[model samples]
Target: MADKRLAIVHVAYGAVGQRQNRRSLSFYFEPRSFNSHTHGRDSANKEPWTTRYGAQQDLGYTGPLSFSHFPYTRCLEDPSQLFDIAIIGFPFDTTTSYRPGARFGPFAIRSGSRRQHARGYTLTWGTSPYDLGAGLHDCGDVPLSAYDNAKAIDQMEAAYTTLLSRPVLGGTNEAYKSQTAAISLDGKEHPRIVTLGGDHTIVIHFDAHLDTWPPSGTTGQERITHGTFFAVAAEENLMTNTSIHAGIRCKMAGIQDVEHDDAVGFQVISTDDIDDYGINNIVKKIRQRIGNSPVYLSLDIDVVDPALAPATGTPETGGWTTREVKRIIRGLSGLNFVGADIVEVAPAYDSADVTGIAAADIVHDFLTMLQLAEPPVPHKGPFSLEDLKYP
Candidate 1:
């Protein structure tokens, strides 16, 4: 009986060994058929995987960084890549008076815009900026020297001048093209620039303080801090006399600062004026002040109350709320805006990224403002029963 059991066990072991040997041989040398359809090689396939290598639709969390995830282009270096509107970054903060972190403002603003997409729609504007026919692209940041304020300022001015000189793409929509015609000071069709700033100094002087401080007698680097760049801009003829400032609440050295600000070609609208005159009135005043001239808008993040947007080089307590500022900006839609910048966003001081997010949303408004042929129609809320006439 023992001998018969041993023979059966040997036979079972031999059968298992034979099956294992066959499996190992098949693993190395099995003949397999390739499915052309699965590999994207089928001639009948209408859409091929190879053709979708550079799709613009991107998930917010992933992908290379750019404002609102617009296609990145070296438009400044290569003018052939045409664009009607370009977003550029100026990352220099050596000249700031109080805080020095605004050099990182552009990056912070871009990072905060991660959740925004070009195709995203805004209820307030009733349209998506990308839906408007405009060739918008991110021109990336202008290279600047960190150690030299004078050189940095020169670089910024040169970059702005170059971008302002570029011809518009005149997108497929004829109405938008016509609306943008002759918007430049030269009475020519020119691309609009939305600048992400290094400091408040680089704008048309929107902030809690009057940036048009009289140039100190001393020349060189001492001459061009963030507080005095508008004075430099005025000297360079970069700003028009029709320019204006809003949200002014800074402590001043008597009324001479106001006199100097006026001489620098900026009409002042104090922070308190918003409380007294209201948002619509402020927008009306700005629109009337700017008229049809090519307007360059410079907004300092400190324009908002410090409690709301504290990540700025200069913070004043009594300032406009982010909503108030956005409302005022939305109201200024029909104005001819050639260039604009939101500056002084130092994210190091930010809490939960409120300031960066505010700056990003403001840029979103900038895009909508640039692309709109006319001002957006205000929404009539559902609660407005006047529209519903009882039968």
Candidate 2:
């Protein structure tokens, strides 16, 4: 059977209903590699990138329109329009303890994402979700002032708050929660908004900002609930909780000491410890903790090997392999998340723009797959490691 184990695991979402039946003829396409952005053309046979982009004078095409300009709106940056998912930027680099230029993250991510979208590097391809009907928009960087990070976070928060309520191209409302009426403009809730960042500190403060929403948006506060942002979000009493910290290794007193507190309510599979403990098991732990809820993913480029993302601020060594990171992302599929972001890319450090491109590709693949996966899992009992099949 050609060693079915790897076969089944490698498929682009071939399994459904039961694991055994997924042994169909396909098992080698990650959602990204599925080639959605082929723009309805064949992947391998489509025009070559350079020639298609008109960079190659040798294999030139003298068409009136340029292939490079096909996606036309690559750098389209602005907000105020609605998207089921919107990309907001927080360009602050001061919080980084090491390198000092993550502020350029949004631009790089945008550029990368644009390139991938132009090519066939995404599965969800277009902006609207086929399974759930959500609209997505790349509403570039959130307006921020360099000197005031807190104020910047507030502005970022306000931007997301706006996105979470705006009507998307006149589609159905995609509001995640509105218990406290956290974000209401003109008396209507917007779509679910995702935020890209300038740095990791944005995550901590965003975690803080989520507290404004009511727990479960139904009744009295239990003091700790999923409405929060941290993995201990419930413990912290914020919205959209359950955090999995990938590509990070630090023992700062403030963050690590809480691990001793069983009630801390958040779980992090730090890349340092996860690599030491074995990635597969860590993947199992991540699957266990997040379950099948609406999660919001935050990826700092430093989480990958510096070689893979050398342009990020606070570059960490021994980060996850590109495949390892991709696996983590895939494992999170079939999940309903509010949004995702990749930050800490400083193109100034890398003229080649490798990190930015990878970040863009990763984000695009995730967002695209999010739009392609089966609808929100039936809120049944949590799935276990046993749910996996290896034959």
Candidate 3:
């Protein structure tokens, strides 16, 4: 005896008659025929969405799915939608020493961002980032060559560079387009980049190791890793020595590593300094050291105490709380922050998605800072420190 069950799924976009803020997709399933195969497979007692790719037989379900489903536009579909700032996911965690689950950081961060759509408006900054006139997009994650570390780093660098080359003003603030268009970096204009990290190794770390030095006597593959990406960034002139590192609590490779980091052009502030100087002084120090230079802020989740951010690769104890970090981040407004990243969130280790939620909000702060920053006026003469300060 042959027995089968048929299921029909209906997918609809927008509402019954409205189209303006169509954010939800409705799905209705109806079962009918009992003898036909769903998609070349038996239809008896098996889930229809079970195939090589884990996708259901094509019944066609295209609604709306994006970072937050608010102002959704892809880079390929409309490059003009990407401007001022763009979110790029670097889902590579191959160089992690203690934990390996940070590769899932991007997915967790995006998933956690679902809670942010309702309040994209920032009360602290007194503005909605979406309404600020800067072009924004969820350009999606960068596809990395999984096995090759060097190639993966190259891919990240190239992908970032490509996005940087795009024009920065085209959204509602088209009136200011001519003004901001004149904004240049080292004689070239570039869009700012906000990266969702895979691990602490990808940028800066919070634990007792600095991944800035080249592995001694290395060849092709050994030359690059997540920890070494910043070294490569220096080689490529992606950033300058005026860069700064915060929430440093880990031990270093050696005293020379300190010299190496100094040579690399970074001034680091340890977590203990917060106990001595407090957050306000820390903010002032960062602003003083990084004066006027374009900035790229890389925040490792481990920078927070393990109690607050346990889902990281190598967590050090006695770190700052989420509130403290957020305050510091907010205090960083008005700096020439061209790019930033929040990395090393391993959702598997999280208790109730706390780490992921914290990361998403951190990224939200980054966007807010970009919006609050004073738009660059056309440089009439040589750029000076006063030019970087914002109202």
Q: Pick the candidate with the highest TM-score.
A: 1
**Candidate 1 residue-wise lDDT, 243-296, digit = tens:** 788889999888878888888888889999987888889889888887777676
Better of 1 and 3 by lDDT: 1
Tens digit of per-residue lDDT, candidate 3, span 35-90: 24344334433444365347532221222434444455546345556566678788
**Candidate 2 deviation (Cα RMSD):** 18.5
Go through the candidates in order and give the clash count of each: 0, 17, 3
Candidate 2 residue lDDT tens string, 84-156 = 5555667776544456777777666665554332354323233323233455555556668777655765666
Q: What TM-scores do the predictions have? A: 0.80, 0.57, 0.71
Write the number of the candidate with greater lDDT, choosing between 2 and 3. 3
| Residue pair clashes in candidate 1 | none
lDDT (C-alpha, whole model) for all candidates? 0.78, 0.51, 0.66
lDDT, residue 379, candidate 3: 29
What are the candidates' C-alpha RMSDs?
A: 10.0, 18.5, 12.2
